[model samples]
Target: MNSSQTEWAEAEFSRGWRLILASAFGVGFGSIGFVTYSIGAFVDPLGREFGWTRTEVQGAIAFGVGLGGFLAPIVGYMIDRHGGRKIALWGLVGVAVGYLMASASQGSLGYFYLAYAAVALLGAGSGPVSWTRAVAGHFHGRRGLALALTLSGTGMAAIFVPPYAVFVVENCGWRVGYMALALLPMVALALAVFFFFPDRSSPGGAAPVHARTLTGFTLREAVSSYRFWLLLASILAMYIGITGIVPNLIPALTDKGFTPTVAASIQSGYGISLIIARLGIGWLLDRFWGPGVAAVTLTSPVVACLILMGEPSYATALLASVLVGASAGAELDLLAYFTARYFGMRNYGRIYGLLYMGVALGAGLGPISFAYLSQISGSYTASFQVALALFAFGGMSILFLGRYPRGDFGHEARPA
Candidate 1:
């Protein structure tokens, strides 16, 4: 093997990857474990126990996740100023407290709302902004793979959390489930951040100049750049498309004649695909043209939408889930990578914070939009068509990014 290729290989598997991967696990529990993955389980129990309507239980999600979108920029700023380690520790504490609040719910809808909003607002630190920043700063030559391994944590959560929560609730009860969710973030995540995670900058100190150069854009420059806006547009479209289909995945499959159990099994492909896409796409980005990889990955969802619009079958449903999950996985990897590539890391926390709003907004809106479409048309065909068009638009826009920034394309060579 060539000397440079060997160096790159060594760096890719270095010990640092383990640390970042561990941090990713902590970040995943903070996000997917307690928040996204666990919420569905909460819905049924909350409904049965308190007689809360589905809409009311779901509204708590909207309140927490939507308002958190507004606070993302603030969290990013804190990450930039305070460093990821500190922010992550604080965020884990907030997550634990939020779930404790959920566990203590006394049948008040207002109290439920408060519980959710508290998590989103205070737990923003444990989100992508904090965890990803540390990984991004540490790895350069193999940044793509490093980030991929880190993000695989969310995929892990998707696979693990749903069944785990079910097992807990089935045996103990919902309050116990909430308490279990809190412990991972409070004890595990806290320990991970303190013992393993490293900060790019010393606590309360300035970032190294080279790190700033690598990040490229300041907060103002990032907001004003056409490329930034383009990326945001793409992010929004992809999220809207994926989330639109995912919420209705079971029903959509059932409509196609699959049994409920089979339909649920097909949905598992999404989580599996998520892990594969992150690693495969990350590997490709390091070798190929970056934007080209994004454009192709994002465009695959259009085919998934088309399949959903066609005749029903087990094979077709599984294919659609895999394709959609691939695109969904690429969303954050590209978002995190491109943000650092285009803008400098000096303000990465804030810029990424603003960009993640797309994630929040689309996830919140996508499901509702799909439901509205199904309600109106009495079928999912119309929603699939709309999503297909948006995915295409979003994919094509990546071409406008032109190329990776100067010095960004495999320029550095460092171990660990």
Candidate 2:
């Protein structure tokens, strides 16, 4: 609140901005960004090529990402034992390999699903679990803003990957599109992360001495807390709602008579709003009640669900997309912020990793479930109705978190 405090926060950014930028790039091109965001662009192509139905095509996500979610706790434990930099670097390489495997998929849908699963399992470290751990370690004063900046990479991926994938799939075929996605993490993100993200646990890595003294609950202690379970339940519901809508958005719009390009453009609106939400909500988290902020931000998407349920104009569709994007944007930010505040950095990687599994599982389920609902009901309306309920439930559930534990640096302890 004081000028000195403000300056200190600013100083944290000055010292750690490279780490933030690296993290952003890693997250954007990593599993959540390239793998998750680009699936929509590939859905129609993959379906047509393999004679797969919508649910079948979307099922790749369920088998791939859902099963991969089981690895989060393991990845988290590794990061806690070692450091994120090495894990992230190797994960990016594995993600590139996964994309190549997807590109090489034959007519076998099982093979395609396995390829995606490989991507999720191999690239697990490249997700928020590793990146946010490093970022959390580096910035305490402006932690919220730092995390927002880091995670806005997903928004960036949302903005670029769909259209890019669509453009590539349209011109060069879907195989080439997957190959193109591979290049992202292989070249640019890998270079950025290797150069900028330092391993604090490694010799000669040059972390602040005080970082070694950071404190928090162990994995067992964190798991025992009621707040941990509450956070997991809320995360699962919120991600299920948003992720179900996102990859399905382009197809749903195209079915409603929008052109593929137009649908992709509308999805861009979602990405733009996501970026806005990350930055704006990040700022708010530092100064406001995080649960209250999450409650309002996540719940606003109910209106988006309502908008999409009816036939709407392009502008309305865009509005709905933006609202959904906004909610998606807030989900990871809240997850990372809440995990650090409630549990502490002692077991941050493992705690956040377990929580990230909820995100991964929800993401995996959302698309397949949405596609299944659409297949049965002949429209996205049923899915939207279900998602609307989920958004409300997830948003409201954050209110039950009560308060942050005392003595967590950078977060004020509220009265119990």
lDDT assessment of candidate 1: 0.73
Instruction: Give a tens-digit lDDT track for model 1, residues 1-416.
Output: 36876686565456475467556766677642336555655655787999985446656655556666667788888777656666666777887888888899999999988998888877777777777777776666677887888887777766666556666876799999888888877665655755655444433222443444443567888899898889889988888787777656655666778754476566667768988999998998778887899999999988898889988477877899889879877888888888877775667778889998887777667765775687678888999999999999988898899866675421233433
The candidate scoring highest on TM-score is: 2
Best by lDDT: 2
RMSD of 1: 3.9
Candidate 2, backbone clash total: 0
Report the C-alpha lDDT of model 2 over 272-376, residue by residue, as the tens digit: 999999999999999998999999999989999999999989999999999999998899999999998888877788889898889989989999999999999
What TM-score does prediction 2 earn?
0.95
Each prediction's RMSD over C-alphas, in Å, is: 3.9, 3.0
